[model samples]
Target: MAINLAILGATGAVGQELLRLLEARALPLGELRLLASPRSAGRQLQFRGETRTVQAVSPESFEGIDVAIFSAGGGTSREWAPIAASKGACVIDNSSAWRMDPEVPLVVPECNLEAGRARPKGIIANPNCSTIQMVVALKPLHDAAGVKRVVVATYQAISGAGARAIEAFQEQCRAAANGEAVDPGPLKGQLAQNLLMHWSVDEASGYQEEELKMVHETRKILGDESIQVSPTAVRVPVLHAHSESLTIELGRPMDAAEARTLLAAAPGITLVDDFAAGAYPTPLTAAGTDPVYVGRIREDVGNPGGLQMWVVSDNLRKGAALNAVQIAEGLFA
Candidate 1:
C-alpha cells in the first residue's frame, strides 16, 4: 500500500538526500510532503520527476502521514518527534535527540535489525555517521572472532556538519587558492588546509562528541558492554565521505587473509584491499556510494589476536538518511 510520507528539514543536506534516495534507492514511496523551517516555506525541490513545495512543519503536519523521517537539528526533533509520533506516523529520526533515549531504538539495520521492533516511543534513531560506518565494517569481524576491544580514529568529512559548512569549506578552499586568509564558518578554524583533533567538543567528557557517539552507540547497537571502545575523532579537508582507522582486538587471532574473506562476503561491505594494486577506499572515491568500503587489512603484530583495518562510507548515505530509509523500508520487507 502506498502511504503518505513526510521529510522533515527537507532543505538540509541529509533531508535532500532522503528526497533523492526515496526514488533513487527505489524505497516504497507514497505522497511525499517536504517539511522545513518557515524560512524554507514555499521552496520547491525536485523529487523523482515532480516538483514539491517544502512546508513549514507543525504539530498537525503529520496528521495524514504514515512515516516521518526527521533530519532537522536535535532541538527541533526533541520538540516535534513526539508530536509526529502521537499523530500515528512512525518516526525514523536522523538526529541525536532520541538516540540514547531508553524509549527509542537506535538502529543500524545490518547490526541490529531486530531492535527496530522495540520502538515504544514510535521513533527510531539513526546511528552517528562514524558509528554507522564503523559498525557496518565491525559486525562481520565481531561475529567471526569475538571482538574484545576497538580503537578507532575518524577522518570525518565536513558534510557531517551540514550543507552550509560544506559551502564555507569550499569558500575557504577558493581563498587558499588565491593566497588569502580563509574564513571559518561554523567551525572554529579553516578546515580547508587544516585538521582539527576535535570535531564537536564535549568539555565534560574531554573527548569529541563524535568519538563518544562511536563508543556509546557501538555498545548499544552491538549489545555488548564488554566491547571496549577508545576513539579519536578528527576532521579533515574532505568534502563528503567519513573514514576510520580501526584496531580491533579479538579473543583469538584471525589472520588478515581470513579477515578479508569474511568482509568480502559481508552484506553492505565492499572490500577493495589490494595494497599490491594500489587500490583502497578513499574519501574521494567513497563520496556518493552506499557500501561501507573496508581495506588496509593487516594483522597487528604487537597483539597476535588483533587486526587493523580502514573503513569508509558516504556519511549522508549509510551514516544518516539511507540508514533511516533502510529501517523504514524494512517495515515492509
Candidate 2:
C-alpha cells in the first residue's frame, strides 16, 4: 500500500525542499498533504505538475497520515508531533524538540537505523543540520580508528535560520554593493561580506545553543558516552550549505590514505579530496546536493592520532528536510 504523507511547515525553505525531493525520488504516495501555519494557509504550492493548496496545521491534520515529515520550528513540533503520533502517524521531526528524549531516537539512518526502529514515542528526531553531516563523515572513521575527541569549526549558511535570514543576507549584500548603510538587526551585525562566531544567542553557559547541540547530539548519535566534542558555530554570509572543519582524535594512529579509503566507502558520504588539483568540497559545491562531501583529509600536526577533514552539505536539504524524509522512507520501506 502507498504511504500517506504529510509535510508540516510546507511554506518554509526546508519544507519546500522536502516537496522537491519527494517529487525527485517519486516516492510511493497514496496522498500528499501540505500543512503550514495559519499565516500560510490558502497558499498554493506546486508538486509534480499539480498545485496543492496548503491547509493550516492542527492536531486533526494527522488523522490519516501514515508518515509526517516536520520541518517546522521546535514550537510547532512540540505542540503537534505527539498529537500526530497519538493518532498512529509516525513523525520524523526536524526540530531539536525531542532529540534528547530517551524514548525518541535521534536518527541519521546511515549511523543508527536500528535505534530508529526502537522509537517508543512513535517520533524520531532528526539531529541538528551541522550534526548530521559531521556524523555521517565521522562515523566510518570512528568505527575504523575509534574516535576519542572532536573539535569542529563551522561555516554555517543563513538558510539554517529559515527563509527570513536568507532574505536578510541578500538585502545586506545588495546594500553593501550599492555603498548604502544596512541595518543588521536580524543577525545583530553586518552579515554581508562578513563572518561572525556567534550563530545564535549564547546561553548562560557562554556557548551558543547551536554549538552545544553539536556537542551533545554527536555523542548521542555515536552512542559513545565518553567522546568529547567541542564546536564553534559561525554564521557565514552564504545562503546555503554548511561547512565544517573538524579535527578528530582517534584511539590509534591513522594514515591519511587509510582514512580516505574508509570515508569513501561510507554511505551518504562523497569524497572530494584533491588539494593538488585545487579540488576540495566547498559550501557552494555542496549546496543543492544530498550527500555529505568530505575533503582535506590529513593528519593533524599538533595531536598524535588526530586527523583533520572538511565536511560540507546543504543544511536545508540533507541537514533538515531530506534527512527527515529519508527517515520516513526507512520506516515505510
How far residue 89's Cα lies from its native spot in candidate 1, in Å, is 0.7
Mind giving the per-residue lDDT tens digits that candidate 1 earns over 187-286?
Answer: 6687877997646679997987878888889988888888999999888999899999999998788999999999999889999898789988999999
lDDT agreement of model 1 with the native: 0.88
Q: How many backbone clashes does candidate 1 have?
A: 0
Candidate 2 lDDT by residue in tens digits, 1-333: 699999999899898899889998856898899999999999999999999999999888899999998888899999999899998999999998999999999999899977888878899999999999999998999898788999999999988888877788888899999999987866767889898765565668789889999988998999998889988899898889999999989989998989999999999999999988998999898999899999999989988668999999999988998888778777785
In order of appearance, the predictions have TM-scores of: 0.97, 0.97
Error of 2 at 229 (Å): 0.5
How many angstroms is residue 186 displaced in model 1 relative to the true structure, after the best TM-score fit?
Answer: 1.2
Clashing pairs in 2: none
Residue 181 local lDDT, model 2: 100
TM-score, cand. 1 vs. native: 0.97
Off by over 4 Å in 2: 200-202
Q: Judged by lDDT, which candidate is best?
A: 2
